[model samples]
Target: MPATLPRLSVGETVRVAVGVLAPMLAQGVIIRRPGVVSLADSLDTNRHACRILGDLRERYGAGPVLLRLPVRELAVVLDPDDVATLLDGSPRPFTPANREKVTALRHFEPMGVLISGEERRALRRPWNEDVLDHRESLHRLHDHIVAVVAEELEGLLPSDAPVLTWDRFTPVFWRIVRRVVLGDAARDDEAITDLMVALRAQANWAFLRPRSTRRLRELGRRLRTYVADADPQSIAGVVARTPGVPGTAELGQIPQWLFAFDAAGIATYRALALLTGHPAAMAEVRQEDLPTHRGLRPLARATVLESLRLWPTTLTILRDGVEETHWSGGTAAPGTGFAIISTFFHRDRSRLPWADEFEPAIWDDGRAEISRALVPFSAGPAQCPGRTLVLDVTSELLAGIVSQFDVAAAPPVRIRSERAMPRTLAHNRLRFHLARRAAG
Candidate 1:
């Protein structure tokens, strides 16, 4: 056990947080002692670990939680200020070295820029920079996504049947991304969808090297073949044409684009649900004739940003301290690793007065500082470059949905929030019912 700290009020929160993390304890094993627990069992996955960290933040203020495994030590930090410090000093003092990317994804994307150091980050720049430049072109795919969502809402789910939000949105969302990035042909490609489905499943136990590796390898092969001569404007084209740094695999950066589909869908669905929960907000969104969402019309943007605040796609981000770092009046030793649960700070009343409330007004006027702190895309050099495009696509798709029909929880939806992390473990399943508008 680690040395106990003086009984601060945060102690209770730490206890609760640890209790919450119990279910995820995988059956760890030791080589000498038959059934001894290992650090492998300490974290079910990075996402699961972050959920626990979020709990720590809620239970304790923005501080560190010390966990002393048999031979190793771990610290989970929940402070946003620390997060800024950690991420701002990326690739050196703070680095992304997780079980999933370093282990399972190695075979497929050995040089994956997603969790790479500064060099790989720069090598992968073209793909992301291209997306940033051509976001408008990608935004044009909003109509197709709306059509896809509309069809799901109108044709699939009705008074008689309802679909789980996770089940419903993931395929549609990924499909939209495929259509926009790959090409219009990908919109209806079953092969691509099947591959994506397998990969999505792989995302959970990827560190364990599940059956999904076959699929991931298959995806890498497909990208290598199909993307070789892709249109320069298409996402696949940019990825294919991107010059790989020395000693990196050809298709290294594809996973970064592919994984984003999952996060984007989660945030967008929550935004829709928030809109449904607040009819006035939905109405305001519908009335706005916003062309592009560079900075979305306040109400629509707020709904999205507010939803992100409530349910950030990334539950926690892990960074290893390579050098002694100082932040929020403390020093973390070099080699100490920390996971920041930004959701905790986003919801902390001490930081934002209306932390528990969904208020778009906070994002308005001159409060970009508060909005700046709400980092669902994360912070610093590795922050998601594709955020603006995702938001634009979300705003337009929501507008299209409202234009077609009035959507709501059919028998009244209920959202539960007792989890370590938010968003991904969405509480509402039988989601959004639609009634065809009485002719606008």
Candidate 2:
């Protein structure tokens, strides 16, 4: 057991620095354990773990309970209001430090702006300007996503089988989006895959293989080169461009920035595939009142929320405390890191109606009950800029898939890596027998 610190008085700071690690035990601080978290310990397939956490939240009263995962660890099991509290202000106020260490280790870049005070506001604006600012471009992007999905799913049809392999479906979905968004440059480019693979390997290492840190940096460079080479005029250039907003582009941190996306994007893509790849989830698409006025949008927002809730890309969003703060019985001294877990919070079945079920009807009342607890893309100044684009595009792509193909679940197969976030298939062989839907 770690040493216990007496209950912290207001104004006392939980000081943690490099080479000096102290965990905030419910009781007190302890020296962090050796092998604290290995590559294997890094999250890959989170389904069962998440369920267990949910169970614990219910037993522990459902908000802000910390866990000791074989180490004196700090984790905030959160809800929407907690999420709002943590994420609401610029440079999110309640962001945690340990998670930030992990994040910084992966990407040398200041992508921490997502949680870093001051940078949070600046970083978010450009993302909005480029991806979400213009309605037309954003909609066009969604249409492109829809078109590609239609083409791919259309080829899955006229079959008798009703099973979908998340493995296969995920790659196809990513490939289509990569092609559409990055253009034909990525079509034959093996480097994109290499970039993803290498980055995943690094993220899997976490604290276990600090040696892998250098390798990850190298991979990031290679990836940046590839992207730059792919379309000097577009994708890479835009990312390289300073967002005019101060501190938005800590470009010197390119390698880290790229890796951040690698870790976050892969998980997000996997979660999306799992939700859309399921038969029951897609059933909503057959409904009469679709978002496009022709196809179904039944669980569009619900699906996005649930998937993100179930398998949040990042375990928590970290913020550096700018000023002394008090929230829900906890005091955050200035300079402390605040970690908020939307994943744990979103799964609080007690806070949600029919929370254990997959029914979308509960949120479809138009008031969106789920929104009350939702924070998949987060909220506040650091709320994800790519969020709108992701939702719009994913929904459109899902609509196209259900509209064109008879997607269904497939038998699971063995894979080597389980620690990869977004938990991509090790074999990458998710098989699906495609059949044309009647509507098509």
Clashes of each: 0, 26
lDDT of 1 by residue, 1-440 (tens): 33332122455445534543332222211001112222322332334544555555566555565554333334666565666766777777777654333553454455666666667666665556554443343443344444454554443334555433545545566656666667555656658656655555444355564455567678877776657756454566655666655645546566556656556665677777777767777888878754664335557666777777776556556677767765543556676666565555576655666776667777676553544456767767767767666666666556656666777764435433322223222423437776667776
Worst 10 residues of 1 by lDDT: 27-36
Tens digit per residue, CA lDDT, model 2, 28-145: 1111111332221233323344454454445444234433333333434344665566666654444433454544344343343343434454564555446343233244345555
Q: Which one is best on lDDT?
A: 1
Score candidate 1 by TM-score against the native: 0.75
Best by TM-score: 1
TM-score of each: 0.75, 0.65
| Residue 113, model 2: Cα distance from true site in angstroms | 3.7
Q: Which stretches of candidate 1 lie over 4 Å from their true place?
A: 1-17, 20-63, 98-101, 104-109, 134-169, 210-213, 229-233, 240-250, 291-298, 327-330, 366-368, 371-373, 415-428
In model 2, the runs with Cα more than 4 Å from the true position are 1-80, 95-112, 115-124, 127-129, 132-140, 152-164, 206-247, 250-284, 287-298, 361-371, 411-433, 437-440
